[model samples]
Target: MADRNTPNRPRQRIIERGIELLLALCGSISLLTTLGILGVLVWDSVAFFQDVSILDFLTDTQWTPLFADKHFGILPLLSGTFLTTLIALLVALPLGLLIACYLSEYVRPAVRNVLKPLLELLAAIPTIVYGYFALTFVTPLLQHLIPGLAGFNALSPGLVMGFMLLPLVSSLSEDAMQAVPSGLREGAAALGATRMQTAWRVIIPAAFSGVMVSVILAISRAIGETMIVAVAAGQQPRLTLNPLVPVETITTYIVQVSQGDVAQGSLEYNTIFAVGLSLFLLAFGLNTVGYFLNRRYREHYD
Candidate 1:
């Protein structure tokens, strides 16, 4: 009996070791894939800069890669991207914060359970559908109301993008607000504070850092979004601040160039990488600021 048990124990140990090794290998492969993508992007962007001077790429405002006067000023694209993102944030931030506040403090539990999932469903909807809606429904509505709006202006697309980002901001901000200790609310109430007063003065201030992180995350998502902008926003890359006119964004440019007959190894191909690098840097910087804000400003009530 002892001999049989000893052999079985050894086999069991071997099986456990094999499972552990498999999981470790899988994790390593995932890490390698992420690192590989980053490596390729960096390498391609560096190669692009080698052919085109960094100064020209950064400072030139016109983005005519196919014409005889091929200039690659990335600023117009950057400005368009920023402008749209700013508009989206302006529309999303207040609505998202109010939703977060409602869910965290004001709503009944039954209502919250029903509504939260429905709101999150908005996030799960495919961006292509949003793009189509923007093109068909939103643009016409804007044109009817504003009279001077184009068939494809920045306002409709930006507003739709804001709607898309609202769930993310609200869900994250709600979680942060909910994480505030109940004792704080109780203390405020004990001190004769109303529910709204406690929420606005104590809860929101305590959760400000996390709320800011959510807002930044929404902005990042707005910046990286491609499909809605590609389908709804026009392909004209201008440096104007007029939101009513047609404008091209960085992501839209990438989609336009990738879909068209732009030859590989040409200046146009390199311009894609240059624009992509700028986007990557912008996202990286926003994420870095979010990290610092989370670290430095979060008020721990424990």
Candidate 2:
């Protein structure tokens, strides 16, 4: 017995050490990937700024870098990006919260088990498929109701992008609501509050930080979305608040320029990195806000 136990202890220790090393390696890979992306964006953007001033890039309204007369204004793209993101959030936020509240606070365990996967299936579809569906089906449907709608515009793609991110928001928010203590619900019930009342007053308030995180993540995803905007929305960047007209987002512009015929090291090529840097910064700022919000408002369960 002593010989057998001694041998097994050494083998188990070796296996545990190997598992720890594998986990550490996986963690380091993510950190290294993030660092690599930041390094490339900053390096290329620095080179771009040597020729085109940062002020013009931020202030200029035009984005035609490939034409004989190059205009490197980035505001048009930013405007389109904001317009579409705002449109998407308007469609998503209410729907996502409603779905989350229902799933977390109302549904029976068996029913929830059956329904959650079906709802999440929306996320499994390829994004390019959503782009085509918006372009072919949704846009045509919208045009029928509003005859002035353009063939390529912000509305259809924004709507599709909103639905695409719905599952993510719902799932995260549901988890947060469900994490709230059952004791809170019981106390609300003792005060004669109904389930609906308890959910809105106690559960949602307790989970507000988590709900905000889900919303911020959804916003970031909408801003960075490429294919849906590229295929459905036109490549023309216009600084307009109207969603019916053709517009281009930063992600779409990046895709467009990447596919175009342009020489390497030219201003046209350099603009890609500059736009990428701006996009990175935008997403970073949003996520940073989310982090602080979560930290500031998070409730301790114990």
TM-scores, all models, native as reference: 0.91, 0.93
RMSD of each: 2.3, 2.2
| Model 2: CA > 4 A from native | 1-21, 299-302
Q: Which stretches of candidate 1 lie over 4 Å from their true place?
A: 1-30, 299-302
Model 1: which ten-residue window has the lowest total lDDT? 293-302
lDDT of 1 by residue, 37-94 (tens): 6677788888788887889888888878767987778888887898788889998999
Q: Report the poorest 10 consecutive residues by lDDT, candidate 2.
A: 293-302
Tell how far residue 193 is off in model 1, in angstroms: 1.8
